[model samples]
Target: MTAFILVAGAHTGGWVWRQVAAGLRDSGARAYEVTLTGMDGGGGAAEPGVDLQTHIEELVRLIDRIEGQDVVLVGHCYGIHPVRGAADRRPGRISRIVHVDVGVPEDGDPALKLVPDQTDRERVLSLARENGAGTLPAPTVQEWQRWGSVAGLPDDALARLTEQAVPQPLPTLTQPLRLSGAVAEVPTTGVLCTANGSSIAVVEAMVGLGDPAFQALADPRVTFFELETGHWPMLSAPRELVNVLLRAAAGKGHRVAAVREQPTHLRPFLMDVEERPRERTGRVDLHLPDADGPRPAVVFVHGGPVPAGARPTPRDWPAFVGYAQYAANLGAVGVTVDHRLHELTAYGRAADDIAEAIELVRADPRVDGERVALWFVSAGGLLAADWLAAPPSWLRCVAASYPILAPLPGWGLAGGRFRPAAAVRGAGRLPIVLTRVGLERPEIAVTVEEFVSAAADCGAALEVIDVPLGHHGFETVDPTDASRDAVRRAVRSVLGHLRVGTD
Candidate 1:
């Protein structure tokens, strides 16, 4: 008799496997059902959020606890997450891994990026926010059943199933499965259920043949089975599920079986765009969405165009924390662009190209046709400041940090044609620069004074903040308390000037 180890899905305890275990035990096989963390009637793990690693740990414990020297691991729904993990831990001792009516483990893809699409991502995030007090939410047992096709189950079994459901930790669902030393090379079988004709068909199809993101699981060593039933096959078709498991345990090959309907692909056609060559165009290109009304857009045409591998990250004589997603999350479309070849572009060329990119963003639906702002750091900012001297009607706001060579000659001031104070003098409002008293360089102070003075003439709001501890890039290291404070203030100031709302 084989020792069968069963792994339950999300929000389910080991009790859900009782009937199947009994059937196997009656057949003279020892069956062990493994319950994941937070499902054994405990308060659930708090503080350090539970992730894929944590679930894998629990599974390892279950496998180690079994008295026999043999066991066949079975997983259902999210059970695939840990079953794959255990297989990697000990391949020799385990006989076979069975994924029962479950979504295939998506290897290499970020877990947080799951769900059907971006719109769904937003919905999930909204749900998480509503349930977990501004954090991620752990769904209740009742809630999870609603997500599946459970109406087809017999009333008696359905009632017991709900009673056995335990709230699962939200962290396990969201955390990306790190695969450095994690397991994947074990003999496995997928019992895919796709008869619901539901939106979950995507996930069902993925279980039959996992998504492209984590597609390495479809190797020759892996076996596939089809279960034509509702999502909860344990209650709806446990005999069929168990039969497949028995074949796997017996190490049999080519065991013919019946299924309601086989999965079919729509024969997707690929149109991947490969860039054709272009010679020394030296022009700006903007890509925007098609929509009515104003949309938020961010055009970042600021990199120094350093040769490949020469420059590691962006340059800030005084470093600065980059906010790539910060703008994207605020309903604004953010763009990151590399500047044209040279530092100085034929006098008026830089401004003109910047203007082009801005127009492209303004016309994009995702950007709401709103006049998007420009982002330039150091050298780029210096040029941007020079162009801001005579602003356009659509140009809503302008912001630059540690701008070029100022008249007063700051610590980083060098021989450059552009002066940092130029934008300050021309602006109706003041431009902002990152600075602090303790770490202040005399040259930076001069730069600030020059820009502040110019901003005063233009009647523009001028802000020269003396950041307490650091000069720039405060939030690069640990998401520390002090760094977060400084970055938050800086973000608010910039957004306020741009007339964008931040909640």
Candidate 2:
């Protein structure tokens, strides 16, 4: 029989895993819910000075006690630190390490590094200092949503979570996880919470970035399962979480393919259009038509939270260049601009960058300021929300290709921010041309479908060109005749809305 050790995240304890533990036990597996040091599983004050090392020792003791059985260690969020540290020390005792909606930290990495945003990390540290007890207080009921998504949780469950939360020891966040590289040989499973801002697609995209730190994630022993819930799956969907755990123990989950020699975005564009002469202006690149007269401009927006040091930036990518050149050949100005969306939380900054780029494009002497269209690609789709909600007279149309129209479940975006599916209701007469692919990732396809349904409900002027045989980044990845034809149709439709020849 397989034995499981479940560790809960920050501010919580074994109580949080009650339902999941019960479900696992019902399935004939032995489940052990651990209440880490510095946390309270019952109505009692937390122990002081309980650092990450304390938690690791506790887990190691538990693993040693469980003899003659295969052990699977499950870690969620902050719990991953101790679980990983313990696994590293007792690799032979651990059959598999299951990571739930958490990052894989390397040697000397702290839990604070998982926060991603520097400002947020600083705020957390500040809060810990304010306590004067070497502990960070639990988030208030209202603040819980900011810590991790509260989606799918009932009001009572949320209330219980808030009331039962315990202060986290500061050392747990500051102490670096020490590893001996022994755990690297152990099989691993990643349970991605799609609603909480993680998915298999996101993992694949990161691996494709050629970052050596993430290369290990593409290993054959590392598999993945996606849960369509928030960070606290044990609370929001216990039964489902239990099932995934069981499957993960059997080494039966989706396997991520090895990264290709060339990344998908860097591949050649499907259409073989000739390059046009372009002028560079800061981050913006302008491809002007030979006709010389002021022409309608199509500003192409590339999607990302791309790395700042990525070579040849988005504007210089072959697909963006091809799209720009194709538009220029059709008697229009093709514009591509690079923005600083280096982190998922930087969408606001990205939106501002795009707005600034548009103003610069409109002010260009070779472009007609009154006739402009915005073509958004990939994750850049959310940036169109503001324009769709309140379009300017000069904005002729909007276009998106395999775009993420709604914020994924755990992105923690403001409720009213960058929600194109909801904003499409107010689009009025502004035209929208969406190019969707059949093989798109489920998480992204859901957003596109949501936007389409909303547009239909509002009777908005929306046109969808389906590429049944294509995939995400189809312009480069699925270079079939269908992909090429869809791209051509989309360009013509956007230009038609711009009234390029009619003017």
Q: Choose the strongest candidate by lDDT.
A: 2
Candidate 1, lDDT over the whole model: 0.53
**Cα lDDT for residue 29, model 1?**
86
**Candidate 1's TM-score:** 0.44
Q: Could you give candidate 2's per-residue lDDT for residues 1-503 as a string of tens digits?
A: 89999998888899999999999999999999999877864333446667888899999999999976589999988899999999999999899999988878778988877764445677768866775346677878987766666777888999999999987877788778999999898899999888777889888887776656677889999999998887788999998999999999999999888866888878998887876899999999999888867899999999987877667689988899999999999889999999998877789899999999999999988899999999999999999999999999999999999999998755657567689999998899899999999998877888999999999999999999999989989998998888889999999999999997776
Model 2: ten consecutive residues of lowest lDDT: 40-49
TM match of model 2 to true structure: 0.84
Best by TM-score: 2
Task: State in Å the error of residue 329, model 1.
Answer: 48
lDDT values for all models = 0.53, 0.88
